[model samples]
Target: MSTRTAELLASIALIVFSLGLMWTVHTDGLKIGWVPERGPGSGVWPFWLSLGMALTSLWTLVRWFRRTTPESRNEAPYIESDRFGLVAISFIALTAMIFLVAIVGTYISIALFLGFYMRFVGKHSWPMTSATVLGAVISIYFLFEWQLSKYLPKGLPMFEDGFLWLDNFRWEYFM
Candidate 1:
């Protein structure tokens, strides 16, 4: 598809998605207004953000209809033939990582994704790729599981058991 057609379709999709998000937030019983003394309600930010997104999407649609934006006027293919391979590779890698999250866990999946992307796609040195993957996994573990106390998906039973053992070891020795 052409860039202009892609932009038009994207804008319309965004508008619909934003409106749906707003509606869902409103229906979840979280007040989307200022509370009496507690300040902004729980749904206030999400509702307002979605509203803003919808408004911006509407503006984009208007611009598209008027052909006022350069993207709206451009008739070039959305994905050029030269860049299609890279794009397809990236998409497939991402899909594989997401799928792996259910089998190998979030951290392992993320590490694999980073390693593959950095070493192959980015053509980075092995040391740099290893450092990046390690740092990312450690940081994510510390930030989410440690500080925020939010347990991410740990994949299958074996992986979950391994993580549980690690957590216990940390609590016993470090904490």
Candidate 2:
């Protein structure tokens, strides 16, 4: 298909996906408690993000359809040669990471992913790569696990149900 056609297809797909995501989040519930207003539920961020994505996708779709002149069409390559391999590899790595997350903790999987990505894809020096991984791991831990007093996913073996304790959706003694 032509580049403009492909762009329109992608935009439509994104709009549909974002709408689905928004529906899920709203159905999942955004508030923790009814009376006290204790905290935001797991769906809060996703709901707003999905809304924004949907709106952006809709705007792009409208613009793509309204191309009044040949000059209005984008001239840039639909998929740059330099980025094709990187994009494919990224999708593969992401799928693998999702599978790995079910077996290991999020922190461990994310830390390893960050380290490898920084070292390989970013082509950074050893010290810089290590520092980036360390910083990411530490920041995530402090924000979610320590400061917020929440538990991230530890996979099925350790956590059994694979739900984070900080979410408070389940009643685990350790939590």
Candidate 3:
């Protein structure tokens, strides 16, 4: 209804989702190592995050309840009416990018998301958008793909094998 109400609702929703996610992660074998390594389990991060969310939500709920006055109750909207559309669209774009992660690889999705945000939402010139997107892609390519040697999620096994096949191609013969 109001900004405070909306934020309280959103916080409650996040608290519930985080708790559920933590439970799921805990049930699905949090720790990979047993005795020697004593590394953090899969649920470790989520568990702590969930705890924080729960505490924050409780605090917000308490504060909102305590701040109940006639004037405070009828405060201005949480977000400006004119900015709602832009905010909603930006949130939708972010959610769409997350959903697309399993469809396309991270690199392609990141590129597409950046292009959409920069050119469409941000209203930047085409040249600026193109340059920024290219720079981001190249930087990520060098960072994770080359320097860190971390393999990002490639969606499915068939796609992974396809990339592997392409990667194994020797360029020395052609050179």
Candidate 4:
């Protein structure tokens, strides 16, 4: 499809999606305003965010109709032939990562994804790729598991046992 057609379709889709999200939030009965003790209700952020998205989408639609935006005026193909390979590879990698999350756990899947993306797609040095992968894993582990006390998915039983061992080690040495 042409860029102009893609832009128009995306804008309309966003508008519909935003409206649906807003309706869902309203129907859930979560107050969109401030509560008695709490500063803001649970639905306040989502409702306002959806409203903003809808407004922005409407603006984009208007611009598209007027052919004001560059994308709206451009008739070029959305994905060029040469660039399609990269896009396909990236999509496949993302899909693989998501699928691996259910089999190897979040941390392992994320590490693999980062490693593959950085080393292959980004063409970064091995040291740089390894450091980035390690940093991301450590940061996520500390932020969610250590600080927030929220345990992420551990995948299969073997992976769960491994994570439990790591948790025990962390508690024993760090805590």
lDDT (C-alpha, whole model) for all candidates: 0.96, 0.74, 0.74, 0.97
Candidate 2 TM-score, true structure as reference:
0.51
Candidates arranged by lDDT, highest first: 4, 1, 2, 3
Task: Please give each candidate's TM-score.
Answer: 0.62, 0.51, 0.58, 0.60
Score candidate 4 by lDDT.
0.97
- Compared with the true structure, the alpha-carbon lDDT of candidate 3 equals 0.74
Q: Candidate 1: worst 10 consecutive residues by lDDT?
A: 166-175
Better of 2 and 3 by lDDT: 2
The model with the greatest lDDT is 4
Pairs of residues at least 3 apart in sequence or in different chains that clash in candidate 3: 30-42
Order the numbered candidates by TM-score, best leading: 1, 4, 3, 2
Candidate 1 root-mean-square deviation in Å: 5.7
Worst 10 residues of 4 by lDDT: 30-39
Residue 172, model 4, lDDT: 98
Query: 1-175 in candidate 2: lDDT tens per residue?
Result: 3567677788899999999988877777664233356566666678778889999988887878798435239666667778888998888777777777878878768877887777888788999988888898789877887678776777766654444444454234434
- Which segments of candidate 4 are over 4 A away from where they belong? 7-73
lDDT of 3 by residue, 98-132 (tens): 88778776767788899999999999999999999
Error of 2 at 14 (Å): 8.8
User: Which one is best on TM-score?
Assistant: 1
Off by over 4 Å in 1: 7-72
Candidate 1: residue 114 lDDT (0-100): 92
Question: What is candidate 4's lDDT per residue for 118-170, written digit by digit as tens?
Answer: 99999999999999999999999999999999989989999999999999999
lDDT of 1 at 79: 94
